[model samples]
Target: MADERLIAALDFHTMEDVQKLVAELGDSVSYYKVGMELFYSVGAPVVTWLRQQGKDVFLDLKLHDIPNTAAGGICSLMRLGATMLNVHASGGYTMMKTAVDRMHAEADKMGIKCPKLIAVTVLTSINQEDWEGLGQAIQIKSAVVRYAKLAKKAGLDGVVASAQEAALIREACGDDFLIVTPGIRPAGSDTNDQSRVVTPAEALSNGASHLVVGRPIYAADNPVLAAENIIKEMENVK
Candidate 1:
């Protein structure tokens, strides 16, 4: 159950904040995600620090570029010792395949386990209206399915999608393909900037492999208690 319940987003602005959160969460959660903000602030040093503390890290840089460029970037990320990493699915098949293959090759060369490569299908911050305005004719659900299929064909391990799309992605890509869900808000919590949101229990019951929680835990009055509550909710669902 602990394996499925959590992937706490370390969305801090400084290394100090990250250290505080790690201390607060302790072994209650084993996985931590370092997104762009924290990564930019502390760089690869943070990944080294997290490993020293025995936590598995997910580097969420969401690399997107030409195939060669994206492959180079993923190789560098693999050297940083990421357990998982993400690329933009919209970067297209060649770019996604390049990133995955390069990372695997580099890991093999270095005698380390290859990081699980996942693609970001759609950000949780956007909605159907936003997609329509951006020239997408299909609804959000259909669009997510489209990208999930594309990612699988491109040799990606899975995708980062909102929990609302988890069931459909599983249907389209099969049960083994990973779905790392973000935009999770516990029941009755403020939605903040996230538009596609679900409770941890809903995400788990709906077939999410991981729940990426940020504000609800980081901004809570008592963060440790907040994390424990989320773990409890996930246990109930399991």
Candidate 2:
């Protein structure tokens, strides 16, 4: 279904909002991303609850730390039964590889499937000027491509990047690597705080394997209809 391409971002601050969204949009979108705010407030129980409702959960803590510590964190999160997870590409190759290796080992020990290890290339909230200020010499698109290449070299499944960079990332990393794009807004929807944004069709056509949509759907007058409209937009491509 087109819903497979739409991973509704559960960026709520409380469990009540999460529950309402789940109940309202159940089965319309199979994948749900439990980002920092919700995760910090509710913890693993939320992941368990989402799974119980038959939804695939993406535990997006964006783990980044020393090699050993990051590895341990990934192992722990994998045991939570997440379908996808992320680590910062800027964390360096050793940290990413260590996390990937440890995740595989732990999953094997528990006889469980490991989630796709996606690297966070850059936050969509940032712009080219932001990168330049941070001492990054290249433009935003070039930096994203460089990071995606590094992640692939470190054996990551894919990367989390802005939809605007999806095509560049795919060109640099090839078709096999996954590109999970966030900052997606439907036509006429407010961009909010997201600086790098694209429509559902634009993202998918640009080679994004999945799109994380939050406020555009959740904050809408009718979330179900909003989600349905997005699915229609995605399906209209190609």
Candidate 3:
């Protein structure tokens, strides 16, 4: 059951690869993430195909631009029917709020279900040094709390965080607020570029509403079995 929260990252190079991976993963995963690389390469067709399959999608574009332009992007992508989408919290309050407001207006005008709008607080790739290098005075946890608060104020549904920070976010943002965490690594897997990694169960236990896993599943010897094992692992967290 916890497997339902697992969002498979379709970071593949081609649609053929995505279809093969999806076939391998099957109904075991109901959600997928389409980031810049894949989306730019194939455009909206992958989103179209995923919608056709009745799969929920997380459009991880991390849009960051002027208020009007970002809002325009959000509205355009929501029309593609992704169930979840995001903007960069670093984009500042006006940009994030404008995206939320205008997208809501567009959705209302079209009478379509509004997609979940989340914000990326801090990428799992960076650590404290990286944060400081970005010329920020605050530490990682403090910055995440601040950004998460700002995103919420901008009317976002959730924030993209690391499982390691899920508890802090839950404490700061409350239970009703969602925290969709990436950088999930099962036991004995490579950490890749993620600096704040946690197991799926650990993420769940720490108040992550959803988990996003990519390489751990896609790069395994048997992807389908790997997904099943990850689900089993997530179930065992409690």
C-alpha-based local distance difference test score of model 2? 0.91
Could you give candidate 3's per-residue lDDT for residues 1-238 as a string of tens digits?
3266899999986999989988778888999999988999999999999999888899999998999999999999999999999999999999999999999999999999999999999999999898889898978988888889999888999999988889989988888898999999998889989999998889999999999999998898998888899899878775
What C-alpha root-mean-square deviation, in Å, does candidate 2 show against the real structure? 1.0
- On residues 37-71, what C-alpha lDDT tens digit does candidate 1 reach at each position? 99998899999999899889989999999999999
Steric clashes per prediction: 0, 0, 0
- Enumerate residue pairs that collide in model 3: none
Q: Which 10-residue window of candidate 2 scores lowest in summed lDDT?
A: 1-10
- Segments in model 3 whose C-alpha atoms lie over 4 Å from true places: none
Model 2 stretches astray by more than 4 angstroms: none
**Lowest-sum lDDT 10-residue window in model 1:** 1-10
Residue 35 lDDT in candidate 2: 95
Question: Between which residue pairs do clashes occur in model 1?
Answer: none
- Residues 1-238 of candidate 2 have per-residue lDDT tens digits of 4377789999888999999999998678888999999999999999999988888988899998999999999888888888999999999999999999889888888888878998999999998888789998888998889999999998999999998999999899898999999999998988899999999999999999999999998998999999999999888875
| Model 2 CA lDDT for position 1 | 49
